[model samples]
Target: MPETNTARLVHRLATLRERLQPEMDRREFLRTLVTGGYALGMAQLLGVEDFLAADDGEVPIVTARVRENPDDPFSLVEQTRDVPAEWYAAVQNAFELNERLARIAYTGYLGSAVVPGDYASGTASISIGVSNEGQSAREMIRDVSEGISINTETIIEIEEIEDGFEYAEPRYVESVDDGRVPSGIACETPSSLATLSPALYHPDEEEAFFVTAEHAFKDEPDPVGHPLALPLDRVERLELGTVVYAHPGEDFVAVEPNGEMRPVSRIAAPSPVRVRGQYTRLGLADLVARGEELEKVGALTGHTTGRIQGVDAVTCFTDEFCRRGQIRWGGEMDLTDGDSGSVSYHSDPDGRDDDVLVAGFNNARTWWPGQSYVWGVSAYKLTAEHGYHF
Candidate 1:
């Protein structure tokens, strides 16, 4: 009779799993159960602590320890962190589960982001954004009891973006003003208008270029020939120069100067905002821990500040593939059409008041109903993916 009850309990668990994950097949679901609750994914299974010391229970993960490249994406630093064994195992299980489901891409799987919490708390949640067709909210709640932590977070619905930046009156960049060609001003190409970034140094090329969002272009990106111009007073346009390089995926276009104007390491604020350096993933996490906000100056939006929402966010909603090392911050209203190339920056803690460090580039964002935060690629990601720095 006791054996019958035990068997029944297992059957009930299997049935509950089916109810929760309607998208996963029975065989696949059973494999996931075996993978998560048993060997290959279990860290502290009952009576298994004999295998290793209590202090050794933490898992040394490479991915969690972001790449160690301060300059380029090619150099990988082999540093590891000691994460709680159980938490690491759970994260691994979640990754496997997400991977299996993503392979199927069920009817309404919008996207997913892994939100890592305090390591001591052994808590981490995967926020998945999906449409109504896949699984209902009630079923998902039940799955939580089984240690399947995937939150169906819905953000951004309307894709409407207002027109590009247009000045009520005419304005132009003056060559006479030193540090005038700084960030936060409008930079126009043949196709679109984008916010100008501070002088980005290409160590390998040994040159600096005026950078902006590549998507600001109407059609395809012109890497070498396209010129970037700034609107000004006497002359209709101040030519920055032809595009030296264009990274559509990273969403930055590096323009070489053709005229007398030179790019400076300053932001277009009433007071000087100097570019000191950039933040690592750890640095961004520290900001998140302290509940700090970053400020940005967009060509259209002008200036606005908002709290950082998530760090080391992997966004798969944009293109065919996924974009890792992204920072989600600010309100959606803080950014607009021409604001794509602007940067989010925090004041340097050790440097002077005017010195600031780059956080990330303001590109795409959430425009849905329930959610209201801006999202962008992080500077660390650019250094990890490509060797460019501001």
Candidate 2:
């Protein structure tokens, strides 16, 4: 019986090698033999050990979760996470394929996102948004896909979100009973009402500035000179500052404080939620694998909690220019017209009452027929682009 079992194992190994032979490099094929018995990704997929590691192959996957500096957006201090290597490889593969698809975005390619699998499940997939025109581009798409599972959404056309409601002009708030104005409160732009966010730290200037979504000022040709303020009512408004800089691509704006009012590290929750710090790209991936949910406060929605659907997503569906490194979570309904500029957060597992780490900024929700979820730029992307942190 033992001899028979050994023979069966040999047969399975031969079969796996034969199937992977055409695709794998000779060096990789040889290195895979170090696993001895399990097929590629099988051991790690089963939560036994890392299949990718040749030596002993029981390596633990660790990633950073919490940061040391809660106030500094650029702070790199983080909590370590032990993840399943198979899950990590799968999610990493999804991110690579998502990038490749974006690089050669043909006329019909609408957009794509990276969907990560739960821990121990060892699965990852990419969802692509495409138009009917892109079907003819299949061969090239397939070449780029490299056998990765790609789900495509065919749309004839796409449109920007439009609601004709106009906001009351110059509405003001004299004061909040609380001294610090948390995020998810009504803030004033020249033409519309938008949500307020926590302080945005710019490393170059070493300054903490008030922040919100850039699209809130989309109606204005240039938002640079626009005033940002707090609205108590139509008659009593508090001024925050003017738009120092606007990043239309990322969908966020930095406001310089002009009055005594300032941006704080607090979020508007029934319980006090203080900003701990932001997550790195891997940190967000770890959050998804652990089946964790994120919470956010919006001007209209108040407070809501939702799962992280995908990470490192590329959204081409929103504007003419594609937005990369987006986080998709919750249903589109979780966000409303006045919800833009709110920050999505996750509670610190370390149990700090006020400490909640931010996931991303909520800019726009779903508009495509099939897609659902609020999408926005991650804090990591903001740091990568402009040396700014939330």
Candidate 3:
């Protein structure tokens, strides 16, 4: 009976070895064991840490890391037509000239005002650029003086001055006179200046001479509103994803999978905001002059999107911290104090490509609920203006 039992056991062991031979190959077995051990270690190090701190064994559910939404058609309208290379060059030169002229005119005026303590007395001239088509140029100059008050009664006034082209000859006539009891009597001297004729004073110039092609080209009428479609393929081409970090007071400290750290700005965005509308609508008309320059550059990458929740209120270190003139998308993407500098991105259908543009950077979030006010620095603007690329 014992001999028969031993024979049966031997037969069963041989059958089991034959059945498990494929899985027990030395190389395969080693690979499996290593992989399993690595996975287990990672779970214990990362996943287990997050899970153990919870009140219950049940893991807390966080919002999904990505979202897909239908593209809006109104956001896709191309605002400008492609101009001939030569014409485009001229347009660019003209735009530059206009900007230079504006700076020169304003700075000259301010410099004059600065003499004699006028600046100290809060008496300074402010100059703003206005295009001929009744559109204001992008550059604005604000001069605030802290000393010297203006004596309007003693000052001479000039009206209807037509300053000619910056390159043209000057046509201004100026004469200074002291205030005294004398009507047209050159008592202290003719203390006044005026334009003699339309030669070249300070008249508003109207022409398309220096208009940036981007600004000159009007939006074509599109009944279908195709511009709003999210360019999914382009987004994918950029390989965009958000960089998550922890907020340390007013600043952001980078958090790595290994718990390593670094410091960053305290901007926050709980949800990705879709940017639509033309460059003009976004207040980027000025930067559009350099659009061609931007075309040669690369877009930002590694940006991802995730939903931020449980935010009651958010505050910035300074009132003007995120109040710059950047387009903001209003929605219920909650981000709290320690969540600043978190990147928000929309999912792209095409994956990563070269043509996709990085629209904005996380900047700030409004505290109020039902009013998801999130602000970001327009990446488009930075690219167009400063040739910035990330």
Candidate 4:
């Protein structure tokens, strides 16, 4: 080749590399924001140079979605996606505004969720749930903030609650089976039977726990340290673990395994699937925008799938204090009494077909007249508030 032609080619290659440098740096910055839980303080530290320099069409947002190494949580890899710039801005603003609204948590405020619009729409809105008695709260919500849209729904308590408990045979593990227990089977509490959830790991302690709904032991004289067992049949049961920590507000309990058997990162369904990681706030929003369905394996309901109703939700309906970072998905039929602790999940985009990322634990279902969906504390919320991962 001629010297002039070779020089031109080399120059073009260098120019291309220079153009991609900013984008690559931006990706890394966004990854830190997400993995760090997107705290406002952290954002201030990591200046938005690349974010601000980008054109108005689209921008890359790091998803809290991670690919977990089952044996090592520290080795988790963050994921990213290119989203419309307008949509990204709208969702980010909506999230911040949602947090502000939650802090206020005015009287009669039942709950709220941030809904992200589709890509083409590039919009976001907040759905605030208020009890009929919260007239002042409704007025505050209407004038809460400007720019971001707010939608309010009146939650009317029903006179008679529909029985959501369904009768089903309990699944038991054989005595000589593998030492690793998969989730979605029946585990007995001192007071009631509840569905098992995927393994939750604490990075700092490097410990894994067997998780279930805390309400399962609501009637216990002393809940903590209470033995949690697996029923072999109607008459026999095997000791699985003991409740180490119980967060009633989040409606989940972490059990310390007795070492006879450890919790595995898998779910028991028709075709067993492994738990890869979990969805982030934006990851769940992406699913909602794409109209994706969440699948779950519950003790009573068995395997079922349903649409995601809302993400980053705050619910004050059932408890004295409000629960933030809740996920509202599926419907009443997707969960039942014995189904509490079952996890809602979607196929992992970066993993094998049978691999799935958890959305959250299915702690309860709405029995109210107007709403009909299952709600639980999201995995992201748990990670942010407490250092737990799938």
The best candidate in terms of TM-score: 4
**Candidate 1 TM-score, true structure as reference:** 0.67
The segments of candidate 1 whose C-alpha lies over 4 angstroms from its true place after superposition are: 1-107, 114-124, 133-149, 155-180, 221-223, 233-235, 316-321
Residue lDDT tens for model 1, 1-390: 366976975775555444433234335444655654445344343222322332444533332222144333233343333446555544445544555445556555666544555555555556666666555543644454247566675544434543333453322344435534888888887877778887777668867688888888767546568788887653567787888788877778888887577777789865758876777765665465456789998877887899887666666666766555677889888887778888999987655788777898998777666766777888878878777766
Determine which window of 10 residues in candidate 1 has minimal summed lDDT.
45-54
TM-score of each: 0.67, 0.79, 0.21, 0.84
Global fold similarity of model 3 (TM-score): 0.21
Q: In model 3, state the lDDT of residue 290.
A: 22
User: Candidate 4 lDDT, tens digit per residue, 1-390?
Assistant: 557976975675445333332224456645654654445454433435435465545665656556556556567887767677668768877887899988987776788888888888888899888776776676677675668888888878643477856587766655528778889999999889999998898888888899999999989745789988888778987788898888887889899999997898889988999988888889999988888999999888899999988889998877678898999988888888889999999998888999888999999888887788999999998889888889
Model 2 residue 328 distance off true place after TM-score fit, in angstroms = 0.9
Tens digit of per-residue lDDT, candidate 3, span 1-390: 356976965665445333322213334433543443334354443334433343331232221111122132122323332222222222223323333433354321211111111111211221221223222222233212222222111111212222221231211112212211100000000111111000000112210010000100123221111111101231221111121222222221111111121111111112212222213211122122222111100012111233221111112213322122233333323322212222333322232321122324344444432224444444344334433222
Candidate with the greatest lDDT versus the true structure = 4
lDDT, candidate 2, 195-224, per-residue tens: 898888887897778888888886898899
Q: lDDT of candidate 1? A: 0.66
lDDT of 2 at 238: 80
